[model samples]
Target: IDEFWDYDEADRLKAIEISHAYRKSRGRSRR
Candidate 1:
């Protein structure tokens, strides 16, 4: 159960990173 939680946390972080990068790219394109 602990391992699963850790994995989920890592996945959430990764998703956030991806979304952040995506937004940056979109902003650059808009400018």
Candidate 2:
């Protein structure tokens, strides 16, 4: 159970990081 929880947290962080990167790229393109 602990392992599963950790995996979920990692997945969420990865998703957030990807979204942040995507937004940054989009902002740069817009400018």
Candidate 3:
């Protein structure tokens, strides 16, 4: 259970990082 939770947390962080980068790129393209 602990391992599973750790994996999930890592995935969530990675997803958030990707989302942030994507938004930044989109914002630049819009301008």
Best-to-worst ranking by TM-score: 2, 3, 1
Quality of model 2 by C-alpha lDDT: 1.00
**What residue pairs are clashing in model 1?**
none
lDDT of 3 at 26: 100
TM-score of 2: 0.91
Clashes of each: 0, 0, 0
Clashing pairs in 2: none
lDDT of 2 by residue, 1-31 (tens): 9999999999999999999999999999999
* TM-score of model 3 vs. true structure: 0.90
The per-residue C-alpha lDDT of model 2 at residue 5 equals 100
For candidate 3, give the lDDT of residue 21: 100
RMSD of every prediction: 0.5, 0.4, 0.5
Ten-residue stretch with the least lDDT total in model 1: 1-10
Q: Which candidate is the best by TM-score?
A: 2
Model 3, 28: alpha-carbon shift in Å? Answer: 0.6
TM-score of each: 0.89, 0.91, 0.90
C-alpha lDDT values of all predictions: 1.00, 1.00, 1.00
